[model samples]
Target: MTEAINDWMAGFEARIADLQRKSADLQQNIAASGATATSPDGGVRVTVGPTGALQDLQLAPSTTRYPPAELAGIIMRVAAEAQREAAHRVAQAFAPVAEGTDAMRMLQEFLPPPPEHVSDAPVDGLPGVDDIDEPPQPSTPPPSPPPPAAPPRPPRRPSTQDDDDFEQPW
Candidate 1:
């Protein structure tokens, strides 16, 4: 009985050491998690950390060609792309320790959904900016109503009986 108990105790200690090593590896992966992404136009670059928080941003001189609002939109799209990639890295880092566990479920819930692109492509079949160069065709005005159907007849003449002057019915 004593020999069996000793063997079981040794196994338990080894399991604990293995768990510690895995924990250390998980910590290193988490610490190293991050991602970078650039805009399609190559005008903006963004980097994000494990939690999808912004870490750095870079703008090329060509970015000035875009108006301020357009430039801002490009930066926003690039940053979101980087953040999404960082979130994916974080998920991968959790795989060794937290996959298929409640912790992974919570982490997934906390991560942002994939980014949605809104520009360049036509929406609902409407022409995008790239699809047309000419100014939009002027909208046609509605036709005028058929010349007011032959003018209304003049007002009827007043009758003397309807007059209120002189206390008479006229």
Candidate 2:
């Protein structure tokens, strides 16, 4: 019985040491992680840390041409992209630690779903203009009838009282 208990204690100590080593590795990987992204126009760049906090932003000289609102929008877009990249890196770092465990499911619940990828190919359900090859010739429309002529006005009557009544002061 004493030998059996000693063996169990040794196994338990080994498992604890292994877990501590893995935890240390995970922390190191997470600390080293970061991500960066740039705007589509390349006027704005953003960097994010492992926890997805903004670490830095850079703007090109050409970014001055953009209006304030547009610049703000570009900055936000680039920052979001950087944050997504950081989240991806953090998830990758956590992968080995969480694999095949309930922690993996819990970690997935905290992470955002992967972004949907857009394809250059036209949507399957909709018809594309390129599919038609040639533009359809429009059918000739019927000529519209001319507008009806205006009705003729009656001829003016000749005045009998004339210019003499115009001189009276009333």
Winning model by TM-score: 1
The estimated TM-scores of all candidates read: 0.67, 0.62
Clashing pairs in 2: none
- The regions of model 2 sitting more than 4 angstroms off are 114-170
In model 2, the worst 10-residue window by lDDT is 118-127
Residue 118 in candidate 1 has what lDDT? 60
lDDT of 2 by residue, 1-170 (tens): 99999999999999999888888988988887788897655668898899888899999997776667656766776677777778777777788778878977777677766544421112222222333554444457789999999999999989887676767886
- What is the C-alpha local distance difference test score of each model? 0.76, 0.73
Tens digits of per-residue lDDT for model 1 on 83-157?
888887878888888779999999889787877756632223333344466444445677877765687889998
Error of 1 at 122 (Å): 14
Candidate 1 regions exceeding 4 Å error are: 120-170
Report model 2's TM-score to 2 decimal places.
0.62
Q: Candidate 2, 20: how far from true, in Å?
A: 0.9
